[model samples]
Target chain A: MTESTLETSGRDGLDEQAGGQRNSAAPPRSSRGHRFTSYDVEAFEVPGGREEDWRFTPMKRLRGLHDGSASATGSLRVEVDGSSAAKVETVGRDDERLGTGGAPADRVAAQSWNSFTEATVVTIPKETRAADPVTVTVHGPGRDSTAYGHLQVRAEPMSEATVVLDYRGSGVIGDNVEMIAEESARLSVITIHDFEGDATQVSSEHAHLGKDAVFRHFAVTLGGDLVRVNTKVTFADRGGDAEILGVYFTDGGQHQEHRLLMDHAQPNCRSNVTYKGALQGDSARSVWIGDVLIQAAAEGTDTFELNRNLVLTEGARADSVPNLEIETGEIAGAGHASAIGRFDDEQLFYLQARGIPYDQARRLVVRGFFGEILQKITIDEVRERLEAAIDEELAAVGV
Target chain B: MATLEIKDLHAEVETEEGSKEILTGVNLTVSSGETHAFMGPNGSGKSTLAYAIAGHPKYNVTSGSVLLDGEEVLEMSVDERARAGLFLAMQYPVEVPGVSMSNFLRSAATATRGEAPQIRHWVKEVKQAMGNLEIDESFSERSVNEGFSGGEKKRHEILQLDLLDPKFAILDETDSGLDVDALRVVSDGINRYRESGDKGVLLITHYTRILKHIKPDYVHVFVGGQVVESGGPELADELEESGYVRFANKKEATVQS
Candidate 1:
């Protein structure tokens, strides 16, 4: 395997941790006034496109979308317990230093990731298990602006909590989240990205799983101009398990993409990933890329990934790519399957023959597609939110 | 006035090996207020006959006709056929997840009635029908056929029969997987569906246990994909007593012709 590397932009003066070869223009001196020290930034620096794992994603899309690159800090807020938890925070003191904050107003004018707001980090106390789900709401500032926020999570050993993040309002936004699952800890995360028709969204997730830990991630992308989720999970010890699930619906010029990577680095680890989405209207596109890897050192690993997409309309399109990489001579079980097909005409006809209208029959088909993901949610409130998100997406598409 | 008539019915299905024949030159008729039984072993074209009548695309009618109350239903789509008063209780009811039984029934009734029924009235009727089948009230809230046992699936099929209220229905071996208690519940549901006197039924099965409850007026022996013998209900008794070997031999001779 090729060595992973991370680079920093010298002129930008943003905190960057380089993994392999340092860039020639790299800045050595660090600032003390900032909450994040050089060591903190280094720990957060993700492997860029130089690594094989990040090759599928077009780096050009992230060229300017980093946390501190945007000019405007658009109106973004997270509400918990009937009050705003925090305002949208950025990495720079002025707009000139952060470039155009998030996305520009016009589609033609927006270039690369410059439309994203700065990354806002939200920290949850270790071992603090809350009774209610935390709600993070993102409201757009409208016009030409993009917002990016990274809610850093660390659930201490034996702690359990559920986080609900809602992306409402208008405009363009780019968000990313990095979650750390401590030893024997559990975390349930629900994220609903409901962008308006004209807005664009690009988000990423990097999670680390400790020994004997459990992590459940459910992402629902119901609305967006361009939505892409890049998520990666690595099991650090045996007996760790992760469930990565999502439900997405798009129609008419909307682009939704989910790229998932699950690395089983320890023996006796388990990972299950299932994502289902539906596409409607001409020119609508949905993409799913599932990469499951079992290293040679990790014997006795059981991993399975399935991505199924339903094309509700003739002109709508969906692409599913399921990749499996096994580097061991050991006979461990690992498999992947991907299917992209139109609605089952037989099923639709069967429902219709029972006196269901054509339109209602279509709804049932879509419902079945998303039901696979919705059934995994254990909390009632989260499930209801997912249902409402789906309903709103369907209504927006005139279904 | 609700009557089902199959006139010299012939149907063929296209397989990869080319077109094959399933239903070959069969004829039958069932008027309103009558129950007919079609008994045959597996692959005897019983289910094919039912699917052909319901307008399944796989079944091609080469040179026969199906008429319901003098209206030719062979040209209609499956949904159109259902709206025109023809229903088929599948041998294996499909499991459709995320679609509640109540929602499916209401939507089906709306399509057939040309207008959505009042929610209260529809719920009352569905509840009453489900009650007659020994189904709990919670059954309506579940996804259609999903996680339902074989017996529960069969009962749900009967619930559709009662709720859709089709003029003529083809019950395709609905009693095959039911126990004694479930068999009684299913038969009772079917009986209630026909109490209005405007419904006709063609119950197909391999066993005669279902006949004990539905009490068929006529029984036909299906062998070699054709009805080899037709008689009163006593024919079912004869088959139950002697088995289908004799009928199979007779069908082989007919094929040699």
Candidate 2:
């Protein structure tokens, strides 16, 4: 509360920082190669942590995911459960649906594509509604080895379902996930990065929304040594709606980053993005990047993105950058907001003055900070479990 | 049954210009069943005294002693002071987002009462308290003081004063910004708490209008960060006619001479 937090940074002041490239069209001083994306690993060179997208990431901590040295010596275990209406298939690289959603944009993402052995595809049949949510759990190979994996969640036309992709346990890994929502389909993809031990992961998830399709994505990252996720979304036709919500807590010596891009390629489409994170203990760091591109053809696009971060301790830091690019002034609206606030001393003081102890006061403030997004999870089990996880984090720090 | 003492209290606040002394040396005593009105002009350190006693960090106690029942309150933390029966209904009640009023009241009640109030009885107690203050039942579901109007905030403060039932309540300008109807309701709440006979009350205000509704046993004319005169109810009547001009002029004259 002693300092003024940057609320929005706004579209006019995008070049002031490392991540503030307002328009990816000209991109201030970003590399021209940033716009190139491909399925081939050779398309992306080894990042030296200076590119606009890789600047915030610690390249050394990527643990060879950026290079081709991260060899897969150990096997990755995948578990699929729930949703009897959904069909699960382990398809080889030759499967036609393997790369239908989108391609890789970063070096690590391209490496994951070139290395993974098989892909898990969960498809909800056309015009069918799922009774239970599908849970896909991926456990990494421990320290002595690295694991590469792929997952694709496909929702057929007029179908409705929820998919939970959970990443847990040890080791280093790079992976790709694609979520394709067909015409008029309603799909929600929730990814939880709850890695244990010294796990390092680079995940890129591509989501494609067809005409009139509705897609909702959630990224809940809690435990990790170094976890970075890239979420790219594209709308193929009009009336498609997409929402991406992310919640993360970074502990001591931990780094968690979520990079988001929403591509409004079709007219009359809509998208909303929100992310909240809290960092505590020494050297705890977090990064949130929201890049929204509204093409000229998407004349009626309506979108807003917001990212908020709370730093709970002295050595903890949070970086929030929201970039908005609008090619057409005819669009309905395009807006982005970012805020990085330290533990509000006034908020803590207010609660403590009411006879609540210091620890309880801190917990209350943290809960309130994340309450708005957690309330939107819609899935009861996920919401409750995340609440417990937050409490456990507070207890770990003796808040 | 209880005594609240503030002896030779000096407090300062940090600002851009550096630490500025607010409360020069404040001495006052209020015992059970007694109401003392500390009347002063703006910037005379009236609210500063309230915050200093409540242990707000912004108001640093440079040199002072605040004792409740012979326990040094200055040595206690903010919440500890509340547990020791020293309550301050802040002039601007803070907005605690995501914390429901019911939850906050229960947590504070538990801390002060040394245990959780029985849920069944606690609901009834809170409902009755809110009803007595004319607050809507839905207020319990909302965040504490968030989006509350000026009148609503004051009423909520009195509601806490009633539910918490602290032995000594220091109300800092509780009557400010309240409409006529809200002032009546808030005064009634304070009056009910005072009628308990075992509680001590320190009412801080700039105007005498509130005195018409809730009479104080002692009225202290405050100026120059300390009380200049102490008298009975008739002193309020005198101030009502003369205002604080004479008291302020006397201080200016004393300072120059």
Candidate 3:
């Protein structure tokens, strides 16, 4: 019998002590100058693509979002339509909700934060439940121009609301989205990136959940020449729950990257992240990085993040990295899983054995891969549209 | 009467070392409404024959002719062979994550039947098939064999067999890993397919347990890469009473001499 060299690590809990005591020794908030998380774009140096977070991303395709070379030449047309029960206002940067969640960690996000002259704030009043979703559309006029945008969504105490941010058209864009779910409130945010020809978009989204609040964020990237979305979730108090789900498809010569961070800072908070993607055609690429940090104070924190990527054709690459940082052993649970591979031959054979053609079977498998995450989107129309977009992607691959 | 003829069948499989020949000069014939049980010990090329007939890419036919109803079976792709009225109840069914059993069954049915079945009728047929195999209706919504137990996988295989209703069926160790109850259920499903009266069955097994429930019209005892002996149902009884000890000893003696 030969020894198997396959290294398998799934469902294995990391040794709590091995995670280090930095959480206990270091002050929660630094007394010195502004401390830089990756989101503190101004406090950190501009990325040259060699940074750990930016290494997997194609810097050339970013169209100057990495540095300060790209400026706002043209603007993104922003439209906020809310139900009669909700309130929508185009507030200035001085609005209270502007930086309530967190600071922009990357250069493009900070640039977007500084460049946007006006910020759109969509508010769901305390104790008021909205039946229809608040739709925010950011359309880019097809041009070789750069623009900046910021949108703040606040669901007050005990309010229930769903927000859909639909992005389409062309041009370069840098944007920041801030969502605050107050105590006992429920908020579901769906961000869809459906860009046309030669579009480049970099966006950062930060969501802060209050006590007992539930936050669900879905990021669906279907069409784009280059797109990178960084979504960060933090707990404001105990019992806060967050679920981050994403689905992306990268076609030939397209680059789609999704970076997510789940910060469990309060006790009794829970978070779950599941992001799935598929890539096809030569030069098609995708990157998914899921980072979960359970701070020392986050006792009773339950968290698990999973990312799975399916590479369909030759020259298509998928990079998946799942990182978990635990500062205490008193936590309830914390683990992560990431898998990047081509289609399972066994699965293909099984489907083919049932008399389904090879191409149809592949399509079904890819559809199934995205369906698990896409179904988590509560909005019916948006879910159906994403499904159709996936079909179109599959057709483009000639599957 | 549709017939499957395997004449001078030879096949090799790609291994880590190199391409190793498995089925050497195998010959068999089966017509509709007949069952041929191929019994052999481990590594006697029993499953290889089934895979070769099913046109698995892993198994290469060096020199052979697999004819289904007077057409070239080996030349067809895996799905084409399946669509050409061939069914294989694998020992270890692959688990396809994400694709639900209902969708998989409907796709298979459509591919084999050459058209999509009506949604209402398809749902009813799937429900009835699941019920017959003692499977819960919820199983149809679960991904194909993703988290299924051994018995559940076997039952799913039988479920496919019943729904597809192919002209020729290959049962590859379909009795393995099944408990007595599951064995009975699975055997009953196979028997039901056989009773359809216009299908041929190739029952491959290492044990005679399944033969008791679904009797084979003929039993071929395989040794090495070829059939060493062929007889009626009593051959299984004889083999069960003694074993493949004599055949193993004969092969060893021949190798030594």
Model 3 ranges off by over 4 Å: A1-42, A94-96, B118-124, B248-257
lDDT of 1 at B23: 86
In order, what are the TM-scores of chain A for the candidates?
0.74, 0.93, 0.89
Which candidate leads in lDDT? 2
Could you tell me the TM-score of chain B in model 1? 0.95
For each candidate, the DockQ is: 0.39, 0.69, 0.78
Task: Evaluate candidate 2 and give its CAPRI docking class based on DockQ.
Answer: medium
Query: What's the alpha carbon RMSD for model 1?
Result: 9.5
lDDT of each: 0.71, 0.86, 0.84
lDDT of 1 by residue, A212-249 (tens): 88989888888767777777776878878888888888
Q: How accurately is candidate 1 docked according to DockQ?
A: 0.39
TM-score for candidate 1, residues paired by index: 0.68
DockQ result, candidate 2 = 0.69
True contacts kept of each: 0.52, 0.63, 0.82
